[model samples]
Target chain A: MTTPLVSIDNLTVAFPIGRKLFGPPPMVKAVKNVSLSIPKGSFVGLVGESGSGKTTLGRAILQAAPITDGKITYDDGERRYDIASLSKDKLRDFRSQAQLIFQDPYAALSPRMTVRDIIAEPLEVMGLTKTREETDARVREIAAKCRINLEHLRRYPHAFSGGQRQRISIARTLAAGPKFVVADECVAALDVSIQADILNLLKQLQRDLDLTYLFISHDLSVVAHVCDYVAVMYLGEIVEEGPTREIFANPQHDYTKALLAAIPSLDPDQRSRVVSFERGTVTVDG
Target chain B: MSLLSVENLSIRFKTDEGLITTVENVSFDIQEGEVLGLVGESGSGKSVTAKAIMQLNGRNTVYDPASKITLHGGPDIDILSLKRERDMLPIRGGQISMIFQEPMASFAPAITVGKQMVEQLQIHTTMSKAQAKELSIEMLDRVGITEPARRFDQYVFEFSGGMRQRAMIAMALTTKPRLLIADEPTTALDVTIQRQVIDLMKELIGDFGMSILFITHDLGVIAQTADRVAVMYLGRIMEQGAVRDVLRTPAHAYTRGLLNALPNLDNLDAPLTPIPGDIPSPLERPSGCVFHTRNPELAPGSRYETEIPPMSEIRPGHFAALFPEDVQ
Candidate 1:
């Protein structure tokens, strides 16, 4: 088998819950023993509810979260690094190859920065380009790839709509030319109509750039459309991982089944007929 | 007779940029025991339409002079005509109640859940303080809150997100209002909590025979709970019909775009066909059909750009603004 672009082995992220003064501080165990892999150029989706640790798992893979145990390796076909055990130099190199697209576009971008500045910051911070002309060329090229209007790049983020801001967010992420990207609920905040436009753009860019995506979202409907392979996370563990069609057609886990059954559809009268598993129920299968 | 009738209603916001027209000549009805789902994307004016009925918009909101909002079997008061706060009170909570997207904003943090309920009930009804307290507790139990009396004394913060929504619903339903305007009430909730809330609302609707003007951007939620679905865009009704008809056989291009954009559980790998171009700013309202700019079927320099498409009945009880292609 080809070496996967990203690999994980028994990754766990634990956050101290109580204050230091409290007796025997307990860990929240946000992510517990999650293991997964993403092949090169595959659009992979990580889906779960609010406390399911899907977001934490994504951050852990990026080494943004404190990995309490286990190993995550990133190989971009050029250089390899143990994400959790990287030196400062290796970390700086890794930054050029791995990037994250935030869920809330409003809070992610600096309001004070112009769209050009926002997109150029990553390239400037990484020192990928030395001259002003080089930086402008890269920013405009990536901005066009993300389908942003070139004229709008001079305006502040507040001037653009949600969809436009998202394009800027995508441009910034892609400006780094990362081999692997984690787009965390990137379209959840946009309108349904606008959401489709963004999703389609992301798909087109993925093909053009041969980029591997780790799309994190609570919306099953979105994941169903964008992802080829999906991993259903629950309480910090992946309960089911399979091809998107197989999982959606015949979801093995009860939680996955419920999540599928819960999407409010265009058909106003289509209610959930399946029995939902209540909290504290013991699972018969993984 | 319908429980509520909204006719020729239009709303515009007085932004610094100018009067940005949001919702245009929109009209619909809510039956005594029916759920009317207003489905649209951001700037579709679904929320604005619902809010117009409640007169909930700020001072800068301009309701068109020709707007007529009548409540049947209500207090015989014209909702739009009621100018004074005292005049709007009986209609606001007594006959009609509203639930919001965020429950926390509507709920008070300093007061106990029961105290707020009792106070709301006292102000609406002629019940004594003790009587209101007892009734409010029973209402909480009715909404399936475990240990109603014990939970009543807890502050809004004590309740979880789901529990807080349930409490909000309990408070809204206490007055036994005839109409309920739920504006994306489950948008912020998890799938599981959203399911629970939908189930609870269905039960309440059946029991009380109350009409619900359900507003949400999620087509799936509207499909599950609403009897009739109205698709709105740029402050106008794009289409309206039975949920089954509108969703399964959407006639309007905007409605089709919304359904197509929705990720289907059946086809996980199919790329979402999002409508191209962002929703036009309210300030630059379209000249003809509001959706023409984004409609794929639109021909350049077509009549749609020059002439407004009037809403025409396409089938029995199904209405949509027809394009040139739709006529023949």
Candidate 2:
């Protein structure tokens, strides 16, 4: 097919545990040799339990995490940047194009700043807008797109609820006009009803802005619902990746099957249907 | 007779802003050996209701005079009437024990897991330290902790997330409480671990013949563990009924919205329809029905906006807080 927006080839990220005088210093490989591709304007989900290295891979794609090996290429069909060897100036330019939406809305936003200032901070930091008026206009435009009322712009994050605060965070992420966003567990903290609202907002924003999203979450039902493609991470390795429908319908990996069965079903009659796996059976691969 | 009965329960907290009503006129009952699930969002006051049963709210909490909680195993005891903390000791951990969402917070960091469990047993029962230790080891092994003897001497930090939660469960059940309050115990667990915990709880419930008040925001967990379910919204019970009836045919508009909002595996292509509008802040609670603001079925200026609907019986045992005329 055509060129993908972001392509990862055998990416690896490792952290040294401690200082060593002789031999090799023991290192923990967070993201093992794994390769994946994200089509332009598609919502790709990377799902794994804790310590599965999903978060590290997401950070590596944005060049926020150290790339110990392999390559990551980002292309918007305009300019392609090899993220591993970007210069200071080029990395700054890339920052505006790649953004991150954090999980905890409470901790992500600055409590001291008004909603207006929080959204405008990204634009100001990147020097994307020229004047104060231009910054305000851009902020308001993205705020309106995110469904945040203009009246609430003067209020601090403390005044907003969890769902409203998340909308403000999304507005800030989009204010930078990023082509790709890594929403790491962005909707995990929200109530189910509120989660649907945020998911719909993200999907709507993708259509309106033609944005590519790396939706990182541990909730399988959520990934099945929103993501166009799904990748399963197990112990720093991608055990499975395919279209969401295909993966959900016929999971090839044992870990993927276990995860799907582990989800508590809403139907009361299905209570006895859960497939049980022995403890420590799904531990990380060496 | 029911194991526990809460009648006309109303709870308010004296905050700096004003007296905020967190739970209003809520009432429910749990039979012996029954599991009743209390389901709601963050501000729906499910946690407050659970805490009120244990009398565990902060100092600012004010309970209405009409509120009554009765525990009926031995002599019918009025739980709310026990004004002193010492008088409520037997009910708190002896008759009723609680496990929280965060096991780390509940566990003592400096002490060994076995010490805490034995200490609790000594306080509640006439068990010697040696006997308590033996019982604690057995309990740990029952909860599926490997190397129970070694784990008994370890601190909470030494245990994994799932193991810690299991240890908390083991500690809570060590006393063989008549009623257990599990406030989102599985919410913090991974899905696989959650499955294990849920299975363990079911097995323990059967073995001990104890009732449980399972509070959580997830309907899936409620469906699996609860015999009965109560749906709350903004400090009010919107629906109460058998789990099967509630899940199969939800009567309340808010209940319907909640079920619709969930991403079901049965229909992957179905669009998720969130309940409209954010849950109104407790400070600015609506004038009439608590869920009217976000309920899509209610028209603007409808009677539901001005008058509170009583819990009307739709099925034999299923009740929905809606006008009789509203029921289809």
Candidate 3:
């Protein structure tokens, strides 16, 4: 259990801004020298703001983004692969082991496809099962685990509400049986009550499936609720990392402390402290 | 004295399915210089009630004859009586300025941010062009936008998300309206930027001393800004009271459900207890107590399902929709 499912060292992801015929093009480094280890079956949280490079780090680990430098090793007991140096054949194999869930449920799924077809598409593409009968069986199993109603599977995406659509999306992601899942703001679009339901479902599935998760979100309270380990990401770098309780109770970095302080407290008698981010005072790396 | 009062407000939209009542028998009043928070989920009809005050609903929308909205500022203006759009002019930007959730959508893409501010002033007041421009720049600077003179000529797309929201605030406050209706102003921004905007609004409220009808679903934001709180369900006001009294000691079951669903930083280990069911669609709206279907406290055949409970005053200012069957 102590073995790291995902190990990274000095990972960097940069995109070229503009093209100039004369000199080398300027580069925007979305992620810079980030190193972290997600232990097997552990829920690791990555927290940051818009320009903080949390999403970039998640994408870089999946090899969806180009890695300019550094090493990424994903090991899920049976298969060991270096994500940065995967060949076409190995890349296909790596994708089956890892998957990602997006933020918007409305746009995530196709309108024309039925819920059963949408969930079955992943397994079919990955060639996880040989026959249509096996695919149907697997889809039904994942749907039940995600708390999706079996009767609703024959209907289209438009028939469901935002929360229901999100459940369908989760069922699709799990169809391929990914050992590592990167849930990027998965529950941000939902209402508070439904958001709780989805969070509980995710926790239960994590236990039942024995999967590892890298949960990326901007909401600190949500991260504190489900994550076992917390990593605080600032601009292109992780400022701090520790157990969720210790990181929240005794944060070392000033940015982490400021983030925790800014959440509006529920008590009306107390004033929720507002630490305005004065952008001019801080320096940025070129 | 109260600055605005809305009584027995009911709004229904004529849809293909039928007439769907979005807001029903909702009533509340806002005192001068006080912020009243309207809290509700997506189908809760909080926004419909806010828009009904300004007559901003669509063509298919219908308001009941019994609904009455009175603005007690400057002159006693019967808002519902102003049938013509032209009659709505004096109240729209003159007395009540409104800011929306999306800052970019509110602004004109082709025009400079400063020009829009000046245009708003011209529509509401008779200030000279030069005077309006000067005032616009000053207001922008007051909202903490650095180099206001420079930012004045810049388009909205050029500004960052936080800065664009600051520009929106600057525009809304330029007319010096007596009341402001802010609908989810900070929902789209990052937490750090959201804090900045909240602080700016608090400082502005202190300086202007105007009433605000703040509408949003986030309880934390409501706790930070509002003085009084009104919790709304499908189409009814479930609870209303002074912020301290209502939030500290919530009476209605729906209000209790909402608070329980939020992630508590103080009690990290406590499980979030969500209300049992979804907000029923308009076609299947409950007849008596709007939230009876989702109320975890009561089961089927309860009295709440048969009768619409009156909003009884539990304390001096706190009120909740409850029946004697449960209160005793």
Highest-scoring model, lDDT: 2
Instruction: Residues A1-286, candidate 1: write the lDDT tens digits.
Output: 3568999999988887656574656677777788898999899999998888899988988789999899999987779999999999889889888899988889999999999999999999999999999999999999999988899889999888888889999999999899789999999899988888888888899999888999999988788888989999988889999988889888899988888876665545455665668664222211
| C-alpha local distance difference test of each model | 0.87, 0.93, 0.90
Instruction: Candidate 3: list runs displaced more than 4 Å.
Output: A274-286
lDDT of 2: 0.93
Give one digit per residue, the lDDT tens place, for model 3 in B1-328: 9999999999999999999999999999999999999999988998888888878989899999999999995679999999899999988977998888999899999999999999989999899999999999999999999999999999999998889999998888989988999989999998888888998999999999989999999999999899999999988999999998888889999989988999999989999777776678778889789999889898789889978999988888999999855653
What's the ranking of the predictions by DockQ, best on top?
2, 3, 1
Q: What TM-score would every model get versus the actual structure? A: 0.95, 0.98, 0.97
Q: For residues B66-101, what per-residue lDDT tens digits would candidate 2 score against the true structure?
A: 999999978999999998999999989999999999
Query: Chain B alone, model 2: TM-score?
Result: 0.99
Clashes of each: 16, 0, 0
Model 2 chain B: weakest 10-residue lDDT segment is B290-299
Candidate 2 residue lDDT tens string, A76-168 = 988889999999999999999999999999999999999999999989998999999999999889999999999999999999889999999
Better of 2 and 3 by lDDT: 2
Candidate 1 deviant stretches above 4 angstroms: A20-24, A265-270, A281-286, B323-325
Clashing residue pairs, backbone N/CA/C < 3 A, model 3: none
Off by over 4 Å in 2: A20-25, A276-286
What is the C-alpha lDDT profile of model 3 across A113-182, one tens digit per residue?
9999999998988899999999999999999999889999999998887788899999998899998999
